[model samples]
Structure formats: C-alpha cells, structure tokens
Target: MNHFQTGRVSTNKNYFLMFLGRKGDSMIEQEIQGASVAWFKIAELIARREREKALGVCRLLAHSFPDRAYELQLEGDILWALEDTLAKDRYTQAAQLYEHNERWVEAIALYEHITTIYPIDYTALADLLFCYAMGNAYDLFTTLCNTLLHKTQTGMLSDTNYTTIMHQAQEKLQKYPTSQHTAWVNDFILWAATK
Candidate 1:
C-alpha cells in the first residue's frame, strides 16, 4: 500500500521521501542511510560505466521501496543505459516494448528519469504525464502539469510547444483510457482546454 492508504506521511529528511514502514525502526534507519549512500554510489557507478554494480543497487532500491518513485526511476535509467551499452540503438525499442506491453510503471519510471535530467523537454514531459495517468500516479502527474503550465504562462514554453504536448497527452488519454485515473486526466484536459 502507499502512504495515503497506510495513513502515514513520510518524515524522512531526504528530498526523496522513503517508504520503509514495514522494516521496523532500526532496519528502516539503516535502510534509509544505505539508500542515501547507495544513491551516490549508484551515480558514481553509472558515471564510470559500471553497469552491473549500478544495476544491482538500483534493483535493490526498487525492490525494497516499491513506492519510491526515485528508486524506480533510477532502475529504469540503469536498465536503459545497460541496454544501450550492450546494443548500439536498442533503447528506443526497449521503451516501445514497455509502452506496448502495458508496462506503464516502467515507462513512467523511464520518463520520470528523463524529465529530471531534461526538465524542459516537452516530449518527455508529455509522455511522463501520460504514463503517470495510466499508472494512477496522479500526484506526480499533477505536480508536473502545474510546473509545465507555469512555464507556459511565463513564456518559457512556447504556445505552439505547449499546445502540441497537451494535444498529444489528450490523444493518449483518449486512446487508452483507464477507469481509475482517467477522471483526473479529463479534469486536467478540461482545465487545459480552458487555458
């Protein structure tokens, strides 16, 4: 279950809130500290092109904290990098596999990683929002939508670009509507339509 379902909001000092409730106090503390350390180690490993070690850390983080978006995103990034390292141009094919296979969770994770590195990338942002909606990650989707809308209002995002992305998002929503999160998608589209 997620934080809302458990009725416990995280109080971790880290920017990425942890979901270590089931691990007990001592273990939770140890895991949190380990996660912090692993984050830096994972970055170093990725920079060094040490794919196996980075993948190990990422997989551990993802399995230990399934609710942590950052961990999932990192796993997706590491997997993408590994694929690209092994094959010259298979990353795109892998992404398409995730999308076609209805693995919205993995797709969202990859897009989240991409968005963090390229905040102003409209295409990635649009896909990220769509995947979030598909996976019922409403909170992340709403937060990103607000950020993009703010950028558009401030002229940081061109009108054409904003419209194009929003239109693409709408098409995705319509094409593969989910019963659960589609309400939020509709609400978002209505708001965007008015704007």
Candidate 2:
C-alpha cells in the first residue's frame, strides 16, 4: 500500500487496540511502527521535491496523530518548505495551518521567524514584537526587547538602526493611549530607552 493508506491503516489499528485495552498486541505495535516508517518516508519525499506525495502522506499522518509533537513538527517543516519553494503568498497558507492546529505560539513565531544570515531582519523583529504584544504576553515582550537591546550593545545590531526602529515603535504605542496593552508596550519602550 502507499504511505498514506499505510498510515490510515495503522491509525485505525491503533485506535482499535486502544479501545480493546490491549496494549501488548504485537499486531498493533507493528502497525504503529509502520506508521512511523511511513512518516519518515513522506519526509524524504518532501526533501526530494515530491510535493504532492509528501503532502498526501503528511496529511494522513497529521490526521492520524493530531497531538503527536513529531507529526506537528513535520507538518510545520513541510509548510516551511513549500513557503520557500512557492511565492510569498504561500506563507499565509502555512500561517493558517498553524492557526488551525491551535499552535498560537508557533504561528506567531513563524510570522516573525528570522535568521541573521541576512544583514538585518527588522520586519521579522517588528512582527514578533507585535505578536507578543497582541497576545498580551508582556513578560515575553519585555524579555525580547531586553535581549535585542543587549545585542545592540554588543554591536550585533547597528545602533542607529535599532534606535530608529525603537523610536518608531514607541511613537506608534503612544497613539493608542487608551489600550492597556499599548501602555505595556510604551512602558517596555521607556525601560529599553533607559538602558
């Protein structure tokens, strides 16, 4: 059978074994092992640019093991791969996938994920900060800004550019005076300014 069919069969067998309270069933164990092998095979297909086959296998695995961390991670990896190979608009689809999975932190992280391989990633940083603020994760927001400030001090970031971005974010925060969340953002900006 194809990887997708194998995954589905394994998933059904696993559920049946669970319902029967038969934890030591060799048949079920083998099926689970088969599913894991299929999952890896799908990952290989993805790496080989077999997009349709990879997606089919990944979809089956995702449905079969909705709460499995490895499965979720693989799905995210697949989406990221598609994002790289396709247009920028593909990122929106990946973002939606994270949202559908209710992986809010991952979704936000994806929206703002960055690498220093490039000169600067101000847009990613800004989106990350905004995501933290919008989620009311004040502690995280503070920690992120503090880390960025430290990086700037260590010369990892260009001081002039960092300052300019901070100033703009602060200005934007000031415009929403009535929002407690904005107040928190303003407080963080002020604290960063003093340091």
Candidate 3:
C-alpha cells in the first residue's frame, strides 16, 4: 500500500506544504512540477532494483523533457544497467548538452570517462582542458597542458589550436596561480610563446 493508504501520511498536499511553510504557493508548485519528486521516486525504484519500473520512468522523463540533460543522463543510467552499448552514446549526448550550457564541472566529469576509453580523442581532451581551467582545477589543468604541449611538439595537436590553448592556459595560470606548478607553467609559457 502507499504511505497514505497505510495511514502513515496524509494524501493532502497541504500536509507537505506545512513543511514548506515559508516557500510560498508558487515555490511549492514549482518544486512539484520541476520533476524533483518524480526523479526521487525513479531513483528509489532503481535503488530497490525495480529495473523495469525505473526504466519506464526514465523513458517517460526523457520524453517529457527532451532538453533536460539530467533526464537523458537518467535514461542512460538505466540503459547502462541493462548492458546497452548505446548507453555510452546517450551519456555523450548528455555531456554535450552540459557543455553547451557551460556547466564545465559536469561536462568534465563525463568527458573524463569518455576520454579514458578514447584517449586519442583530441576534441574531448581540448574541451576537458577548458573545463579544468574554467573550474580552477589547476593541477588537472597543468597535467593536460603538459600533455597538449607534448602533442603539439609531436605534430599531433594542431599548431593553431595549440597556440590558442597555450595562450588560454597562460592566462589561466596568471588568473589562478598554483604553487607547485608555477615553474612548469612559466617554462611552458615561454616555450609556447616562442613557438
């Protein structure tokens, strides 16, 4: 039985509204309509191993909100649990959506996984570097900068892109200095400027 049917809680929306007393009517409505509750329900079903139900909810959510990255991610999660190869593509699509929204941290988390499987993916590597720099993850940025520098020297990374990335990295270093990497960055900047 449902919580309300079991006499453990009221079915009245007012009962829940009491907890959000200061949130106002519109806020409460928005919170409900925003799919936070539905997402939680689906997450609970997934946790309980109700795989079919969770997949159904995921498909419904993705269909209802085609532009929502989280919905696509949720659908991908369900598909991944079912061992579907297309799940990876779904994840990439969701990551692209995050990138378009300029949500660097989220995009980086996904790109990091994708790049591990496709290490020579320069496009993903480049975007991942940008996200690292944007998030002030200086240590990761330093590592990626060195990798790009190596690639540039080996003619793997394009000269034009390398110059652009090096300049961006130099500006990032100046904007958010890292104590341990300072000398390395300085040397790279000098090398990059000369090239």
Candidate 4:
C-alpha cells in the first residue's frame, strides 16, 4: 500500500525500469535529472536510519539507473552501512564503471578505495596503475608501479593483468617524450618487453 508513483515509475520496479530502458533517448535524457534527485534522496533516507526504506530505494536506484554510475560510491556506502558483504564488490564494480565511462579521476579514487579495503585485490592494483598513468597522475602512477613490482616480486601478478598494465602504460608513452619520466617509461617498457 505504498504511495510513491510517477508518470513512468511505479511500485512494480522491474516494469518501471524496463519502460525507461526501452524509451526513446529524448525521454530518457529528460528523466535523468529526476532520477538523479531520487538518487540523492536515498542518502537522506540512510542518514535518517530508515534502513528498510533505504534498502528499497537502493534496489530501485540499481535497477532504474544501471548505467548512471554517479551514485555508486553512495551505493557502496549504504551497503557497507547495512553490514552487507557486497559492499566491496559494489565499490569494485563502481570503479569498473568509472573506467568504462572514462572518468579517470573517479575511477582512480574508487580503485584506491578498493585496494585499501581489499589489499590483496591484485586486479584493482593493476587497474589503478593504468588509470593513474592514463590520467596523467604521473607521480602516483610511477610510485604505485614501482611499489606493485617490488611487492609482487614472487610473480604473484597474473599474466593478463601484466599485459593490461603494459598496454595501458605503453599506450600513452609517446605523450611524455621530452619529459623527465621519458627514460623511466622506456626503461619500464623495455623491462616489460623482456619479461
């Protein structure tokens, strides 16, 4: 007997989300702002300690705005607050989403968060390295690259991740030809090549 209903959304969550997904681009864009408002309001519910309703809102948010990842940090926070083990998974997924969307800074932040929370999440470390490099956070990039190599001296890094790391670093190598990190980048590239 709940009462929150709108022109396109309804209590039947899946149906509402389906409608939105199938709608024309103009309508979807028009509703983005409204959905964003609803997204933030869920934070208020969590702040008020309305756990059940907040969870409901979170489900709606996940379904209705699957592609809109701006609220992922909030989602991870809410899930963490609720003692849900899926919190870290959500954070990692958010990082991937940020990466896919090419929001490098946000992706880096999320990856950093994931690594701190799950220090053994080697994939995150790999992803973070490439992101820091591509985003021109050269200081953090080089620092983490050295740290990762030294720490994983026992060959713990997977081959796929190594290739990914190499590709990401090499893709942007020419950008800094005259820079101080030039020799350093080439040195690493040659090192990776020999490996």
Give the Cα lDDT of each candidate.
0.67, 0.63, 0.70, 0.70
What TM-score quantifies how close candidate 3 is to the native fold? 0.49
Ranked candidates, highest TM-score first = 4, 2, 1, 3
**Model 2 lDDT per residue over 4-48, tens place:** 566775557556666778785796678788788887888798779
Pairs of colliding residues, candidate 1: none
- Give the alpha carbon lDDT tens digit for every residue of 1-195 in model 4: 332444544446556556557555567666787678776877788778777787677767666645656566767878777767788887888888888887999999988988887777766776787677657788897787666566456577655665566555555444544454445555765775564
Candidate 2: minimum summed lDDT over ten consecutive residues — where? Answer: 110-119
Q: How accurate is candidate 3 locally (lDDT)?
A: 0.70
Give the deviation of candidate 1 from the true structure as CA RMSD. Answer: 10.0
Error of 4 at 82 (Å): 2.7
Candidate closest to the true structure, highest TM-score: 4
Q: What are the TM-scores, per candidate, against the unseen true structure?
A: 0.51, 0.52, 0.49, 0.54
Q: Which ten residues in a row have the lowest lDDT in candidate 1?
A: 85-94
Off by over 4 Å in 3: 1-55, 61-67, 81-83, 148-195
Q: Candidate 1, 16: how far from true, in Å? A: 37
Badly placed stretches (over 4 Å) of model 1 are 1-92, 177-183, 193-195
